[model samples]
Target: MNLIEHLKEDVRFEESLKACMNCGVCTAICPAAEFYDYDPRRICDLVQRGDEEEIEQVLRSDTIWYCGQCMSCKTRCPRGNVPGELISVLRKVSQELGLFRHSEKGRQQVLLMNSVHRNIMEIGYCVYPDRVDPDYHPEQGPIWRWYHEHIADIAPKLGANYHGAGPGALRDISEEDLQEVRKIFEVTGGTEFSEKVKKNS
Candidate 1:
């Protein structure tokens, strides 16, 4: 199938994009648009126009990755188009086709896979407190370094279980529960999708 035909196969493409009147409401409300050079209105126009070349270019560019998937555009769209959701579809297609590796932002999928996704499968939490090492995540800064050094002491004082027993913040998830999480990922194609991102990146 052609690129447009492949895009149409995704249910998100149908649900997110109806018609874009170019009113620019989506662009106006998009946080990513404010921060980055992204224009949700223009993206909608391009997808609506169904130019295969342009769509392929979008799949390969940082434009699709710029969307934070906040879905603010969905709330104010005059034509009821959800540009953020459309970006989701575009990102998935890009990963599937290995086109995401063409762009700098898209290549970060590997890091996401190794970090958040991997953590979810192993620990049953996307961002486990122990996993956020200050060395790897220097962006967390000196305060985080202090927190990391003292988390075992400070966590309990703040009412967190830390690495201890049943039920509460930062408590260890049971092995049975972790197995269930892995099963869910396997059944829902999350594992397959992560593998695709790894392969493509």
Candidate 2:
């Protein structure tokens, strides 16, 4: 299938790309462009021109993955284009095509999908503080490490339910609700995508 046609079917991508005048505003406002070899303007041009080879090249490269998805370009585009949304479309296409394995950072989606999705399915929280290993997530800082080590003791003091039933932070999630979450994941292909990412990565 033609890549542009496949991408155009996505509502986000369809709405995001109105036109590109090559004004360079999106690239100028992109934070990723400042730090990495990423340019939203370039992506816009490639997609606008329907350069399938270049678009596929971008999907397999670090360029598409460099987008922080902060939606800065969406807010700043002179033509009302959404470069961030366009990048997301590229990413999803790349993942579906197994092209994400071409980049170092892209390969880490395996770990991210495994950790975050597993947490969501099993615990009903996308991020459970206790499950975060300090060794792996050093950027979480020493304070988070201390919190992880002492959550049981500190949670009750902070008015958190901890493992107790019902609502509020760290409370026990019901099995029924957890099953519902798993069903949602199954229906939405979240589980399949996670497994695919893991296998490909």
Candidate 3:
């Protein structure tokens, strides 16, 4: 299928893009636009035009990855278009087509696969405390270092299970439950998607 056809295959494409009057409301409210050279309004316009070459350029660019998926654009859109949701469709298509490797931000999917995806598949937590080593995450700074060092003590105080069993924050997920999680991913094509991201990266 072509880029537009691939995009249309995603349910979010039709749901997110009803109409775009180019009012730029989505861009105005987008947090990513302030931090990056991203414009949700422009993305909507580009996808709405159904220009295959333009859409392919978008799929290969960093613009799609710039969306944080906070869904803030959904709140204020006069036409009820959800640019954040549209970005999700674009990113998925990019990854499936292996075009994500063409951009710097898109290539970060490998790191995410290693960290978040690995954590989920193994421990059933996307951001497991143990995997969040401060050495790799320097931006976490001294406080995170202190927390990392004293998580055993701090976690208990904060009512987190912290790798322990039973129901609580940061608790250890049972093997049975982890298997269930894996099954969900497998059935949902998440495992296939992860493999695609790895292969593309």
Candidate 4:
């Protein structure tokens, strides 16, 4: 099928993904693949086959949701396949399919993304959902705080730079957006965990 026609229905696997070696290295490290039926290798394989039916089922499966997009798979994939990016593509398709507009977790994820964009856009980085890390030590705090306080330095480590500042930023977030993230965190208990991480940091 042509690109336009494919976009109208199922997401094409793309030639880049068809290069997968099926070495299972991705599964060896995947936290979700180990426990769930989802496998990055298989997902890539199905996408390569243009098996829209099974691929659609895979999209809704916890497989897509459980992917952390850590890029560990990407960095390690000898074939240069980006499993994380593929998952993001699947997720967008999932949303366009009206799959997420109905699910509770999907609703929560959308809420979380809005909150994160708002907070980081204004604050650079944040101790979001405000959850503290119990394992936090004075020498090193949890990932969020460490990322927030020194984003200029730590962000590069995470692969993205944290670049945003107050009303001067491109998008101005309202008070509602800030509160929205906190509320989401409240549901996720991120606030409590953030406090713990920051205190130690």
Candidate 5:
């Protein structure tokens, strides 16, 4: 599809891309630009020019995935543009077109989808203590390991209901609520798209 056609598919993209005056403000304020070779200003420039080939290249490259989606660019842009939101639109387009598989970082979506998606679907929490294995996530630290081991003993002290019903952290999620979440996934096409991503990866 043409760049303009694609842009029209999502109104947010058109709204996100205000005329780039070649101002370096977006790149200057971009945290990803500092740490990585990612420059949202360059992306804006390319897309603003309606260069389909370059935009496709941007979609396939690691540059598009580097945005932290902090929307700091939105806050800093002189034209009221949102490079972070634009990056999000780019990411969705990349994933939908199966272009994300071209980058190593993008390929990691399989791992993220498997873990985070399943965590939300089954436990109703994206990052539950029981699911965080110390071997897999050493960054969680020794304290997390200790807490995981002594959760039963420590949870009561912290006023967390642990496995019981009702409010507070790690509380049991009802089957009814879980079914509702599943319904949302189904209605939003999230489940089908996620399955397609897994298969393509």
Candidate 6:
């Protein structure tokens, strides 16, 4: 069982596979699988068979970004395998590969990641990055004030607190880690600032 290097959490892919029932249900229910012809069943089967390349190919696919973390497939799986969780772990790995920032879907994930990083920098908890409605209203009294007040209402639905006025995000990350992330982002051209620049230019 070789360990895969990851950028964020240390996800043990092997541990998530103990309950693989080979029922083919995960492949059936995955939205990405349906839309992109991605087969989680095949990926899992190949990984179990010691075929790392096949699993790697699956990891490289853009199809992985569709998982919404609903856990619907996980609850219904007869094999006890949480394909959704596995997809999440794969998404983390995919982000490491810098594939996450390429498409619009991927960019959305990057925004979420940036939000969490900002939380780590400012407040310790990862708050949802306050999204603005289509109609820009100055009467809303600044974005922060609106987010601070109304964020609590959505907490119950999200299943997270995400509202505590904790310390703001860190202004500076460790130089070494920051450099590494930047280098990786630069290589993939995935940084939001980079994308914005590219589009404007």
Any runs in candidate 5 off by more than 4 Å, and if so which?
A: none
| Model 3, residue 46: C-alpha shift (Å) | 0.9
In candidate 3, which residue ranges exceed 4 Å CA deviation? none
Measured against the true structure, the TM-scores of the candidates, in listed sequence, are 0.93, 0.93, 0.94, 0.52, 0.94, 0.51
Ranking by TM-score: 3, 5, 1, 2, 4, 6
Residue 156, candidate 5: how far off, in angstroms?
Answer: 1.4
What tens-digit string does per-residue lDDT give for candidate 4 at 32-71? 6766665888877777666667766665555577677777
Q: How accurate locally is residue 13 in candidate 2, as Cα lDDT from 0 to 100? A: 92
lDDT of 1 by residue, 1-201 (tens): 388887887898998899889999998888999999999999999999999999999999999899998889999997777889999889888888899999999999999999999999888889976789999889999999999999998998999999877999999999999998899889988999999889777
**Which structure is stronger by TM-score: 2 or 3?**
3
CA lDDT for candidate 3: 0.92
Clashing pairs in 6: 121-169, 121-170, 122-167, 122-168, 122-169, 122-170, 123-167, 123-168, 123-169
User: Which residue pairs in candidate 2 collide?
Assistant: none
* Clashes within 3 Å, all models in order: 0, 0, 0, 18, 0, 9
Write down the lDDT that model 2 would get.
Answer: 0.86
- Among all windows of 10 consecutive residues in model 1, the one with the lowest summed lDDT is 1-10
Candidates 2 and 6: which is better by TM-score? 2
lDDT of 4 at 196: 38
TM-score of 2: 0.93
Compute the lDDT for candidate 1. 0.90
* Maximum-TM-score candidate: 3
Per residue, candidate 2 scores C-alpha lDDT tens digits across 51-151 of 88888888888888898988988888889999999988988888877889998878877877878877897889988777888998999999989998999
Which should have the higher lDDT, number 1 or number 4?
1
| Clash list (residue pairs), candidate 3 | none
TM-score of 3: 0.94
Candidate 4, residue 75: lDDT: 71
Candidate 2: residue 186 Cα off by (Å): 1.4
